[model samples]
Target chain A: DAMVIQNPRYQVTQFGKPVTLSCSQTLNHNVMYWYQQKSSQAPKLLFHYYDKDFNNEADTPDNFQSRRPNTSFCFLDIRSPGLGDAAMYLCATSRFGGEEQYFGPGTRLTVT
Target chain B: SQQGEEDPQALSIQEGENATMNCSYKTSINNLQWYRQNSGRGLVHLILIRSNEREKHSGRLRVTLDTSKKSSSLLITASRAADTASYFCATESDFGNEKLTFGTGTRLTIIP
Candidate 1:
């Protein structure tokens, strides 16, 4: 089955340490997205990649960055993890302009 | 700010009973989508209703869209314990962008 996959479902990082979360898809979607979700809250858009172009949300912190090395893989890098940054990071994908998005299982980040 | 807001932040119902949740958005949307998320998990797309469409059904799920009111509703009939999860409404703005703004969500608990 074609689906999105995320590595290291659970991650722990120390304050000010850098951490990276990875997402890969078999769906061959042209758009991939990264979302941050805190407990009991909506998933907030961090950024996304349409093909090779990166689009970051205006309110996204400067400490967050993303890279799409190829069609199937996208990575989210946290330059300096903070306690407030601990949350579930989700990765999703969809075909160009498609309304339905397929999401990965998500990576839970614990920043100490 | 969040574009969509779901009402009845939490709901509890017995198995076999139907569950309904409503969502309101602040902008013109190309389409509205509903997603389900189990506790501490990624989201699963349930249904999508386009601006031109009023209602749609899939399996036991029924979704209604009211463009004039800028609102939508999701009805799940014969709910089961497995259906216990958080339901969210996401809107795709008519601006031709694929980014989705999600609602806070309604936490539904189905009593067995």
Candidate 2:
């Protein structure tokens, strides 16, 4: 079945260390998004890629970055992990102008 | 920033009982969608109701939208223990943007 997949469901990183989370999809959607969800809070949109163009949310920290090497793969990079950054990172995709989005199993990041 | 707010942040119900959650948004939306997330997992798209549509149903799930009030409701009939999860409402603004603004989720617990 066509779906989105995220690698390393749980990740542990030390303070100030850099970590990368990966997401890939088989749905062939035109847009990919990355969201950060703190415990008991809404999933906050950090950034997204529409085809090859990157769009970042105004309040997203500069420490967070994303890359989409191809249609099927997108990566999130945290330059310096902080304890406050520990949370579930989710990846999602959808066709252009499509309201329904498909989400991957999220990656839980633990920053020590 | 979150665009939607779900009422009754947490709810508990017995199996076979119906569950209903309401959401209110702050902007004009092209569509409103509901999503489910099991603990420690990714979100699953449940339903989407467009601005021009007042209500829709799929399987045991029913969604209603009130554009004038900027609100929506999700009703799950005969819910089971497996339906225990967090429910979120996301809005797609009418600005032709691809981003989805999500609401703080409602945690529903179904008891067997």
Candidate 3:
């Protein structure tokens, strides 16, 4: 099945240490997105790549960065992990324009 | 806030009952969509309704959009235990950027 995949379903990192989460898709969708989701809350958009053009949400912290090295792969790098940053990181993909999105199983990050 | 709000933050219903969740947004949207997320899992796309369309259905799921009121509703018929999850409504704005603003999700529990 063509779907999105995320590596390290559970990640543990020390405080102030940098952590990288990976996402890849076989769907070959033109748009890739990263979102942060805390317990009992909605997934918050962090940034997205629309065919190499990165669009970051205004409220996204500088510590959060994303890279789409190619069409199928995207990475989320946390410059400095914080306790509050411990949450599920979700990756999604969709075609251009207003369309439905397909999401990966998500990476659960734990900052110690 | 660009994000939408879903009413009845949580719901509990018996199996075979119908479940309905409502969402309201503040801005003009090009399309509205509904998604389901299992506990500690990624979101699954349920249905999508364009602004020009009023209603859409897929199997047991039905979605209704009212662009004039900036609101949408998702109805799940003959709910099963497998349907227990958090449901969210997302909107694609008129900007056509495909940036979706998701509503506060509704957690549904189906008691078998």
Against the true structure, whose TM-score is highest?
Answer: 1
lDDT of 1 by residue, A34-98 (tens): 99999999999999999999998999999999999999999999999999999999999999754
What does candidate 3's lDDT look like per residue over A7-33, in tens digits?
999999999999999999999899999
Clashing pairs in 3: none
In angstroms, the error of model 3 at A65 is 1.1
DockQ value of candidate 1: 0.81
TM-scores vs. true structure, each candidate: 0.99, 0.98, 0.98
Local accuracy of candidate 1 as per-residue lDDT tens digits, B36-109: 99998899999999999999999999999999999999999999999999999999999977799999999999
Model 1 spans > 4 angstroms off: none
As for DockQ, the candidate ahead, 1 or 3, is 3
What CAPRI class is candidate 3? high
> CA lDDT of each candidate?
0.96, 0.94, 0.94
Order of the predicted models by DockQ, top scorer first:
3, 1, 2
Candidate 3 chain B, run of 10 with poorest lDDT: B1-10
- Model 1, position B37, has a per-residue lDDT of 100
